[model samples]
Target: MKPAHSEFPAPPAQLDHDNCRGVASILSRVGDKWSVLVIMMLFNGPKRFNEIKRLIGSISQRMLTLTLRGLERDGLVTRTVFPTIPPRVDYELTDLGRGLSKPVIALGTWAMDHMEQIEAARAHFDQRNDTA
Candidate 1:
């Protein structure tokens, strides 16, 4: 009997033009630095706009607004507004976004673990190239 994982399609060896374009489009969204940071910020739980901005530290107000809107448009996040004396808003990951967190977190951990090795490799490569 085939393994359970066999039910899923294997990674494409070569993507056709349309498939390549689709992959690039999605990567341009989720692979962006700000989007990755925003997704990480929302991974824990809901947070307000200013709170997300504060946590990310260097993102401008306008840029944060745009990032949230893009994530929401992609169905990866949801925005909620509370009716209070002064209105309050919260941003949270959707089910899809939550599903994405596992891989994102794993990738982050892998990067942290391998950072020193990666830097050493880069330095070695640069030294070789510089002296060539």
Candidate 2:
């Protein structure tokens, strides 16, 4: 008797388990509120620590430091130092970070355009679930 064969095809080896982890790292980099704002401000070229804080309006020093450190760790932002009477540091986007601006702006615009519809859908879904 002949044995039956399976019909499903296997996936390419390129679809590796690490893909999700890599995506998660990217999302995590751009996903935080401070990270998004910091990158946006860098769109105007490099800025000193206090200058960024002034433009962002109310970000605390600690939070800004943490966010900048994280961005630096991700290789998206660079920190520069100058030797003078007082040390100075400035932050600017790396090529990769600059490339991210278009995507981030697109996402922000989409959210603004569709937020009302999305909220309405969420309310309707919540009401239906409550009635059920």
Candidate 3:
């Protein structure tokens, strides 16, 4: 018979120093609040710079510009410039970016679903701590 824990999946491969550093670096970039918000904004389709800023509401123009440039540099987004009396620029997700969107959206959905429960838990913890 198989061992009791045999049904469980094996753990992931161990990361060497270099691999760990690389993973950490990438996570620091992609895991930031701004980056996640930007990715979600582009998940549906392309949007103009102003449109994205408007959609996200509180993001400053400079921060939005920096976020777009960083995403473009990382190959998760593309910027297109249209020739017109007034120049137009659009940002769209690359295939690699779309791959990231599925997990990000699921995470966002999970957070939204559990927010009430999470808040209640925090309140309970605080109340208990205060009484102690």
Please list the C-alpha lDDT of all candidates, in the order they appear: 0.92, 0.88, 0.90
TM-score, per-candidate, Cα-based: 0.86, 0.75, 0.86
Put down candidate 1 lDDT per residue, 75-94, tens digits, no spaces.
Answer: 99999999996999999999
Q: What digit string (tens of lDDT, one per residue) describes model 3 on residues 39-94?
A: 99999999999889998899999999999999999999999999986999999999
What TM-score does structure 1 among the candidates reach? 0.86
Error of 3 at 107 (Å): 0.7
Error of 1 at 70 (Å): 0.9
Better by TM-score, candidate 2 or 1: 1
Error of 2 at 93 (Å): 0.6
Displacement of residue 18 (Cα, Å) in model 1 is 1.1
Ranking by lDDT: 1, 3, 2
lDDT of 1 at 70: 93
Candidate 3 versus the native: TM-score?
Answer: 0.86
lDDT, candidate 2, at 69: 95
Task: State how far residue 91 of model 1 sits from its true place (Å).
Answer: 0.3
Which of the predicted structures, 1 or 2, would earn the higher lDDT when compared with the native? 1
Question: Which portions of model 2 show Cα errors greater than 4 Å?
Answer: 1-13, 130-132
What clash pairs does model 3 have? none
- After superposing candidate 3 on the true structure, give the runs of residues whose Cα lies further than 4 Å from its correct spot: 1-11
Better of 2 and 3 by TM-score: 3
